[model samples]
Target: MEVREIALGAGESYELRLTGRGARGYVWTWQVTGNADAVSVSEAAPPPAQTLPGAPLERAYVVRGRSPGGRARIRFAQIRPPYPQEAPYDEFVLEVEVTAATGGP
Candidate 1:
């Protein structure tokens, strides 16, 4: 996975979509590394249960900018049950910057 950078206005929100192979039993999960209050994250829906093998599943997350002049580092990981003893299956980070909202002319 690769890190992504995005910007949003104060009080605004954005939806992020991530993909994983459901047939492999790997699912995407996320958490806010910093500024949890300034930026909130929640899952839009649960991952689909695959009816066929090698099916792709998409998970969506909603991130909101609560205040201006703040940043939030969100980390997402792909893992299976029983926990891995070594490195995680996959991981990525999303860096978000929240700026002041612009006024319409």
Candidate 2:
């Protein structure tokens, strides 16, 4: 699995973009952790998946935000094809981290 890490500044929003080719589509899972409240994050439409050899699938999610001076890490997981005879699309993994506030709260 390929992994990527992202950093976020205060009041900053980000999108996880997916690229490359292959089939069976993708599966994604994310979690946010921080001392801030859950309102600090805003996630837009999830990136589209690369078409694979089998079915066409779609999945999306929004990240919960946090309070000031808090940090969060969002992780994404890739979905694979079922049959052993099927070709594999490029697998993916990601981690997004929001930077804590600069000054003391």
Give the number of the best model, judged by lDDT.
1
Residue 27's lDDT within candidate 1 is: 73
lDDT of 1 by residue, 1-105 (tens): 789999989878899888776678777777786676668888897865544667677779888887788888999888875566545577879999989987879
Task: State the RMSD for candidate 1.
Answer: 2.2
State TM-scores per candidate: 0.81, 0.42
What RMSD, rounded to one decimal, does every model reach? Answer: 2.2, 6.8
Each model's backbone clash number = 0, 9
Where model 2 places Cα greater than 4 Å from the true spot, the runs are 1-6, 20-25, 34-43, 46-66, 80-105
Per-candidate Cα lDDT values, in order, are 0.80, 0.46
lDDT of 2 by residue, 1-105 (tens): 676665655555555554422243444334444443523434456435554456444443444334444544444444343543544444454455556544656
Pairs in steric clash, model 1: none
